[model samples]
Target: MAEPAGGPPRAGLVSVVIPARNAEATIAVQLDALYRQTYPGPWEAVVVDNGSSDGTRAVLRSWQRRMPQLRPVSAPEASGANHARNIGCRLASGELVLCCDADDIVAPGWMAAMVETLRTSPAAGGALERRSLNGTVALAARPPKESDSLLDTFGFLPYPAGANCGFHKELWRRLGGFDESYRYGSDDVEFFWRAQLAGYELGFSPHAVVHYRLRDGPLAIARQLYCYGRSHPRLYRDFRAYGMPRSRIGEAVRAWWRLLVHAGDLAATPERRSAWLAGLALRAGRVAGSVRHRRPYL
Candidate 1:
């Protein structure tokens, strides 16, 4: 957990590390948002470019020239975002680490809010509230205000979305960062569970907000759901091993029921409904892929 050489001291707070892959379209917007942060604290934006074949490198270079705080690190392998994030964490010098995806947009006050909350609390990791881009809904159930303990926050822990989270650098190192063996999903779940078991404090910050973009079309939505479903078994196994709550069966059933109910909404429109059904088919395909390639978490 010592600061890497040639960088600032470990006391520096909140390094924002973004792991990006083929994000040429939105990386600039995210970088610009980072530049506009009002935190005024010691921070750095580490962009781990994960073998992006797209013009993502060009975008990062342009941003780097404009902002000295923006540091670009190349990750030539296509191992996935988790690997890129590990590389970023290793290179980062801040005492605390914040992660953001390239496609998402962080509010101007987001960084300052989380940092302040973490500094005041004894939590190892802090959660930020998330709202969808289309203004559809909040991503997770809001936690009650009176709860001061991590156990009271356990229900909200499962709600910890990867994009809006912050953690202490020492705790992150102790937890071994992210498990790279996970190829497509559940890396966040695995890491958070490990952190909780290690007695690391977890807290929530509703003021820190991020806008997450929804999947583009029906095909994309279905693919995402299917991948999520396939990853559930492994997540359940991990949760069980860590003595954490397991909701795999319940989640799977609810997802199926929701899909059935929403089937009518999508089918109500002839043109768009077909696209929705196609997306469902893609989800099914991903589920099949997951089953075929299922790997034991242990």
Candidate 2:
């Protein structure tokens, strides 16, 4: 578990895989941040264009001139971020692979921290900061504070957020990559959980921070949270045999009751209204997901 050793061959090459889809507006910023990384190690950005019909390819073409290590590939066979990640990782030519989202910006020295952590840990995830890229509305809509440690889902195994995670190339092949079927959220959660169940240790690197982006508007935030909630039921259904905890009916009832108690907040400030909408949407999604996935989660 040491840093990639110096050698004539591609010994220490770190491949940063990014999955992009119609991210023309934000991807350039992400690529700019990647170009400014202070890792000081040999790293390549393997950007997989996931069927973007916009000017994303144009943006990538422009950055290619600025970033010599930027290699853009197309992944039209599949439609999800996980699918693009799988495609990008398969084509990556590096000992270590780091996966990040196209919409988020990595902090300077982020790569260095992740590589430094991977020197001792099998797989690692970084801290996500919401304050940097988000405004008051987006921040208020999603109030959960980012954790320095890997997230523990449903009282189950700790898993890394897909946006800022790194692992060895061999481990990715062994785990058969991410589940492409997970078109929604929690793909990273499922992957890391499976990795731990298969005997690999997942670690946290607080110094490797990624400035995570929140959805722009109330509707966008609702959709994201609903998709996340819907995905959790599917996760529960798949991992319950491995002792994944189930959602409690009492808790669900209490959650609804609390929402009702705070119904007045919907008419208050924009921040309060956003928070109320987000809470209601998430719970509704969980209920809908339970029915869709045939698992009584809520």
Candidate 3:
């Protein structure tokens, strides 16, 4: 359980993978956090810019001069986050891979914690928590439980937010990286499940934290919920089609329902009733996905 040797002494060389599209506004903040890390190990940030028409490229260029550790790679194909991440992983030279979104801020000691945990544990990966804009923090939902057997963990795998997870380079390659067929969310879930099924252990590290910035407006929140609802059935269908267990469908449905009921919690004012309405719209999308995929729920 000693720290993995023959790499950078303190922090190790962690390739921080960032997949971004039109993230001109927040990418700088994320990079700033990376540059300021208190963990003084050799590391690099590989940002894959996926067909951003905005000034995202320019912003990255601006930072490249200021932050030598930042490297921007272009992925103009629009293949999605998974595609971009794969590109970054291939280009990365570090022994460890840490994934993050373009819109998140990592804590100062984030990389240090992930390196220490992965080095000491038998886990193929480590999970971290995220703090939402409202200052509410929640564990990244993956692996179902701390004591889950490796295979069962695959059955109910919860993913560390792509923004807050870390894994060894070789293990990532063995799992074949994220499946690009899923152009958005759930790719993380699918990849993690496959890794667990293949006998790789996954664990959690509370210190590797990030602040997730939710969209500022209620309408944006509603849109995000709607997308989640629409993606649920697709996730389940893919899960079953690939021969993984079909256990989480009911949980997905409940999540949709909970979102509908708690839409008010995200709204800032009574005038923002549209957010709740939007939540209903998202719920309908989830139902449609369920029916189209014919995924079973009890």
Best by lDDT, which number?
2
Estimated TM-score for each candidate = 0.78, 0.94, 0.77
Winner on lDDT between 1 and 3 is 3
**Cand. 3 TM to true fold:** 0.77
lDDT of each: 0.66, 0.87, 0.68
For model 2, residues 192-251, the per-residue Cα lDDT tens digits are: 989999999987899999999999988899898888888888998999999999888899
Q: Residue-pair clashes per candidate, as listed?
A: 0, 0, 4
Q: Which stretches of candidate 2 lie over 4 Å from their true place?
A: 1-9, 144-146
Worst 10 residues of 1 by lDDT: 135-144
Between candidates 1 and 2, the one scoring higher on lDDT is 2
Top of the candidates by TM-score: 2
lDDT of 1 by residue, 255-279 (tens): 5676677777564654346444544
lDDT of 3 by residue, 1-298 (tens): 0111223312357788899899998899999988988877788888999889899989988998999888889888667888988888877778788888898788788888877877854343333333344321111111123321222333456556566777877777887878887664566677777776788778777777677665544456556656556666777676666665654657767867776677765455433454454557566667766776686421
> Local error of candidate 3 at 230, Å?
2.3
Model 3 error, position 38 (Å): 1.9
RMSD of each: 5.6, 4.4, 6.9
Which candidate do you rate higher for TM-score, 2 or 3? 2
